[model samples]
Target: MDFGCDPGEWTDAWSATGISHHWALGTGHCIAELKALADLMDVEFVEVDPA
Candidate 1:
């Protein structure tokens, strides 16, 4: 969650795709809109602090 803005597009793309580290790792999810996808995949969505 300590990502720098060197390539701001990285964050922008992730946001547009509704993806997060937790979501991709299958450990948890932080994006609210992506929760449905997680539910469909039987994944847990854990809220996280904004970086």
Candidate 2:
């Protein structure tokens, strides 16, 4: 996922998919982490409104 803020804490992209996912994990992993999940999935020919 997009752990851009915590560069040191992020794992490689390959594992987090098809393995499992976490949302609202804890105080340590808060809103930004949830926001990161949005970029985790990409669909071809699909456009999503930011709103």
Per-candidate TM-score against the hidden true structure:
0.33, 0.22
Score residue 46 of candidate 2 by CA lDDT: 25
Task: Report the number of backbone clashes for model 1.
Answer: 0
Q: Cα RMSD (Å) between model 2 and the true structure?
A: 12.5
Q: Look at candidate 1 and give me any clashing residue pairs.
A: none
> Which TM-score value belongs to model 1?
0.33
In order, how many clashes per candidate? Answer: 0, 0
Query: Per-residue lDDT for 1-51 in model 1, tens only?
Result: 445554587657667885655535322343555678778988776655544
Task: Write candidate 2's Cα lDDT for 1-51 as tens digits.
Answer: 355546454545534565456322334345455456556754222232323
- Residue 9 local lDDT, model 2: 45
Candidate 1 stretches with Cα past 4 Å from truth are 1-30
Q: What is the C-alpha lDDT of each candidate?
A: 0.59, 0.44
- Worst 10 contiguous positions by lDDT, candidate 2: 42-51
Clashing pairs for model 2 are none
